[model samples]
Target: MFRRICLQLHWLIGISAGLVLAIMGLSGGMYSFSSELIQLIDPQITRVSPSNAAALSPAILLEKISQHSPYVSSLSLSDDPEQAARVGFMTPQADSGAKKFEQQYLNPYTAELLGKPASEDFFRVVLNLHRKLALDQGGKALTGAATLALLLLIISGMYLRWPTTKSLNWRSWLYLDWRLSGRDFLSRLHVVLATIAMLAYLVFALTSLSWSYEWYRKGLNALLGNDSATISKTANASRAASNQSPSKALDLAAVWTSFRTEVPHYQKLILLLPSGSASTVQILYLDKQAAHPYANNRMVFDAASGVLQTHERYADKSPSAKLMASLYALHSGSFFGSAGMLIMMLVALLMPVLAVTGWTMYLSRRR
Candidate 1:
């Protein structure tokens, strides 16, 4: 009875979410190599030689950019050290009441403006489609449903893959006999791979749900002891202060120096400069030596005064936030670097095979 129930739920969820899962898997596979793909599609945007000397100040870069487009929204520096700095601004069109925002690049060292980087790269588009499920407004619901389905699928799949009394032998665990024929071979492969990928799938599904549902995020945060009120107050205070002292200039270099000094082990650092009316500069970086995968730290600074407003270490995050963040890192394989990412990409590509084989096994039994 238990076995039968498991099989029914497995197929039900698989049939419903299979196509969506396949779409996500395929797109994820493509996105796994996104960095490389972006470079190949548009060499200019991806390639930039660092300045032989120290780059121009953020103030100078902002001044030059504002001269060309005064209504700029925000400017952000590339997290990738090789990439040039980017300045974004809004331009008003006669037909539209609101201005359209765009991004431009500049040589950090020379402060010379580079041509606008193309946003329509192939991999980027694929990533966007995958993340949003290609449905815009409906995408959120679809993605949420798919995530829930995946959770069910993972649980059911584990049961199907569990070693039966007859299959406890070494041959059943590792290899499929050629003499056993096609059906047996496929069933074995399906079960084995599904077993291996189950943990990763669970991580992906749960983290995705955290993004789609506010209740899920808030509930989880509450469980982890993240103070909602404190976070809100901090955000509000940051905004008010920025508005009051909008003219005060920030020292980007000093901010970066302070961040590095504070988090000396972080190997990769990304600084996002505030533009227009915003007073906070955000920095995100990964601590290579951290014990946990979600050890990517985020710090927000007062753009006007360069005062450190919020410094959130991975270890210091609320338990819920840490879990959520770690799940993302694990799912994306960002925690493990290139080799782990490749493994995840391969697992994503193999998911369709597992899904199809499971269906085939059921159909064979039904007939």
Candidate 2:
């Protein structure tokens, strides 16, 4: 009776979330290589041809950029001589809703504006579609529910599909019988593929929790000893609370040298100018040698003094923090390295196939 109940519940949940999961999977597969794809589709918005001379001093580049355009929100630096740095302009307070900045690619060597990046808008749309069908909060809620449902579906399906014969019929459980056709073939494919894809689905669900639930995110950080509020407090204290006045304008040359001494071979380093007296000048860098994207790490520097304030090294993170950070990579299948990403992409592409086949089998049964 209990097994029967689980089987029904699994079917019920799968029916409810199947379409949503399918959409998520399709969109996710597309976005898994978003950074690379965007660049490939349009290199002007992302890459830069390297120059013989060293790139301009950070401060000089900012001054030149400001002269060329009104915005000066933040900028990125790359070690690759061929890649241009990126700069963003702060949106006027009046230009409201879901954005406060627009990005422009810049040639760091000459401080010349390349062009306004367009791929950002495309990804934003994909994000909306993936997160909530572009419905904002309502969409987020729906997707959150779908994520939970999919998780339950996985659990129930596994229970119902558990092997019972000698050695649990390893061959039957692991591989589809090629001899079957039509609904039998589709059903076997759905079951076997879903089983194979369960780990990726679980990773997607757990990682997605942070995007959908504030409480879950806070709880996760706290559990992982990375309470954001506590970190903020520590950051404030480190900002030198006694000195309320803003520090002098930073010399980027000195800062760059300092940063290089720390991370000598970063792929790209994003340096955000301080926004307020209490703010830290932020640095986000991905080491060129890192095996995956999760190695992109963050550092905070004293706004006035340009001294290293705090560093969040990927290697030093706690297990939970490490897990949380790995969520993005896991979702894209980069967690297992390049080969894993390929597997991840395949799973995403197969989601819609599974959904369609499963639903077809369901309808056939009802008939």
Candidate 3:
């Protein structure tokens, strides 16, 4: 009776959310390779010929950027010598739709503006399609619903696909028998691939819950015995909020130096200028092997006092924080680096293929 119920719910949810899952999966798969491909699209602008010379210091780079642009909002460093330094500039209007701040690459050695990279436009479209479905708030809600449905599908699908016996042939369950034809072939192949890809799908689905539901996020936090780890601003953010606003024009150079002393070995550093209520100079730093490269770790400091306000590190993260950080890694397959990315990309593509075959099998069964 329980198996019958699980099967019915699984089929119902899969049919309802299959199209959305496929669209999201395919787009996500493509985006797994976006950054590298984006740079390659316009190498002349995005990539500088590897310089034998050391790149400019953070202060020098920011100063050069400030002179050219209205303000230096932040900057991102690339380990690759060929990669141009990404600098942020404030626009007249807040970014209601696109890139957080208008970003352009600067030739790190020369401080020359490289304009926009080619992948900016392409990623914008793909990201919009992935996140908001090329629409607005309504689209976000729809996608969120689809994500919730996917979570349900994972839970129910696992129950329905449970092996009848522990001794069931592992080969038959794991691989397709090409000798079979028609409905039998589709059913067997679908089960095998679905079973093989379930773990990847499970990771994607679990991570996606945070974005799709606030309740789920809060619940996850509660369940994990920690505060929300999705976005931590302070060093002891797991304990209390300590984002101090030091009202004054920040000395970018000093902030950069302090960071150099604090975190000598870092992956990428982004320095955000104080604004509005946030009078602290927040520097976001990621370790070379941080699970989520960009968003996981941060160090906030008082701009006026030059006193450290908060230092959020991945290693210092609580269980909830670790799980939250793992979201990006799982999503992009960056957890395992190149191999993980390839596996995730392939899994993403397989989502739609499975959806189609599963749908066909259901139809055939009904017939």
Winner by lDDT: 2
Q: For every model shown, what is its TM-score relative to the native structure?
A: 0.79, 0.88, 0.87
Question: Regarding TM-score, does 2 or 3 come out ahead?
Answer: 2
* Candidate 2: tens digits of C-alpha lDDT, residues 174-213: 7888999998898898899988888878878888887788
Q: Residue-pair clashes per candidate, as listed?
A: 1, 1, 2
As a whole number from 0 to 100, the lDDT of residue 298 in candidate 3 is 73
Question: Per-residue lDDT of 1-367 in model 3, one digit per residue for the tens?
Answer: 9888888888888888898888888888878888888877888888887667888877677666766665556677766677788877655445563323467888888888889976778887888888878888887888888888877887787776667788767774687789999999998888788888888988887777777777887787788776654343333432221122123466666776777788877767666667545556776777777665635577777776556777877788776668666777767788778999999999888988988987998898899
- Candidate 3 Cα misplacement greater than 4 A, ranges: 50-53, 94-100, 229-248, 288-296, 365-367
Stretches of candidate 1 exceeding 4 Å from the true structure? 71-81, 90-104, 115-120, 166-174, 228-280, 285-296, 315-320, 362-367
lDDT of 1 by residue, 236-263 (tens): 6534432232233667666666665676
* Candidate 3 colliding pairs: 235-310, 235-311
| Ranking 1 against 2 by TM-score, winner | 2
Give the TM-score (vs. native) of candidate 1.
0.79
